[model samples]
Target: MRERKAAAVRERVREFALELPGAYEDFPWNECVIKVNRKIFVFLFLGHLVAGQGDSPPTVTVKLAHPEAHAHALSAPGAVPTGYGLGRAGWVTVPLGEPGAPDAGLLCDWVEESYRTVAPKRLVARLDAERTAPPGA
Candidate 1:
């Protein structure tokens, strides 16, 4: 049951990332790497952390922005401090709970923020141009 739910959530996330402007699939883990003009924006490690856990599914780490949100995630079950250099930048590692631990909306927002943060200024400007461009101009 938990596996099914986690898969569903992961699929939703994958779909969201697939729609990003310049996102693409990455090898070795089939990880989703969102980019803007070839520059990496956000990385999805859905199956990258499953070596030791065995039956338990791998964890998901989303780069967080607000200090409050980071704090909240750290207190949840299955949640842990993000490893590597992301910890210094306020990324929180939240485990996709059994069937229904992570909130979809919150995850979506985090994903979006992560993508935006790593995107280059020039690409962002291009996105803005597209968004603000007239319907047919």
Candidate 2:
């Protein structure tokens, strides 16, 4: 039951990550990651995929360029700096299936921040333009 919920949350977050401009999935090291312009912006870990992991919650790791957002994400339950020295570079791992985890909307926002941090300048500009453009224009 927990694994199912975690899978659902993982899929939702993965879909949201792919919606960003130039975003796509890649499996380097056999782990799912969302990338923009060939640079990874989100690393998704789904609990059910590995045997014996047993209800390990889904987590997303992102590199946050904004200090406020970084601090905010790290405040979540089970949230922490990403490992392998990525933490020093502002990467944060946020568990999605845990109690008191941030909602899907907030997770999406963090994914966008990561995208903006890693995506090329022109792509980021395009994303900004789309967001600020008039509804009908």
Candidate 3:
């Protein structure tokens, strides 16, 4: 049952990642790197959330410019302090427990916020223009 649940989580996360606008590269150590117009906007890492593991399934950790979003995520259920030096920074980690608990939309919101937070103002403007422009126009 645990294996099945983990597989489901992996599939869901992968699909959600692919749905993000712009191309991405799946990096080593279970990291997802998204590039918009050849610029990196988001990088996601999946690490062991539970102890006693050999390559555990990914729990989402997003990078933020400031600490507000990180604080908010920490307040949410299933979200916890990221260990191994990341928590010391402003990274908040969210676990993949009951899928119903933290739905994909909410996770995607965090990803979107992280992208906006890290991306430069000029790059963000370009991305925003691309987003608002008519498809293929």
Candidate 4:
């Protein structure tokens, strides 16, 4: 059933997001959230979220560094701007369990971008350094 499939997809996406530096999961408000430095960067909404947007259980919301990135995220199928004025600040909703949705690789990239956008400068700098560091370092 789709429910089982949704769970699998959510788990995969959750694992990918959590692997990022400083990323962690919590259930404040009983809602699944992924954060960095106690600041929310990703929210995983399950069931009836954004009703009519898609037939997906888990919809992933991320905050981008700039509103310009909004258009790019929304260009993907089943992706939309987060409502309640969040969209005005560069937030986007990515439907995780929807058919034709972005694969885990692309979704992980988005998660990383969102993490960098909201993460503290020190954490971001560390991530940057890791990228530039040699293979063994």
lDDT agreement of model 2 with the native: 0.85
Best by TM-score: 2
The TM-score values for the models, in the order shown, are: 0.71, 0.87, 0.63, 0.82
Q: Model 1, range 42-117, lDDT digits (tens) per residue?
A: 4556654644665655455666677877777677677766776677886666666453467666676676666666
What are the per-residue Cα lDDT tens digits for candidate 3 across 1-137?
A: 64466446655655665555554655645556565555544444454434554565556666555677677778766666666776676667666554444555676777767666665667567668877999899
Residue 39 alpha-carbon offset, candidate 1, angstroms: 5.4
lDDT of each: 0.64, 0.85, 0.61, 0.79
RMSD of 1: 3.4
Clashing pairs in 2: none
lDDT of 4 by residue, 33-132 (tens): 9999999888888856576656456777888765556677798677877888998778888776566777777666777889988999988888888789
Ten residues in sequence with the least summed lDDT for candidate 1: 39-48
- Model 2 error, position 66 (Å): 1.2
lDDT ranking from best candidate downward:
2, 4, 1, 3
Who wins the lDDT comparison? Answer: 2
Supply the TM-score for candidate 4: 0.82
User: Model 4 residue 78 lDDT?
Assistant: 71
Q: How many residue pairs clash in each candidate?
A: 0, 0, 0, 0
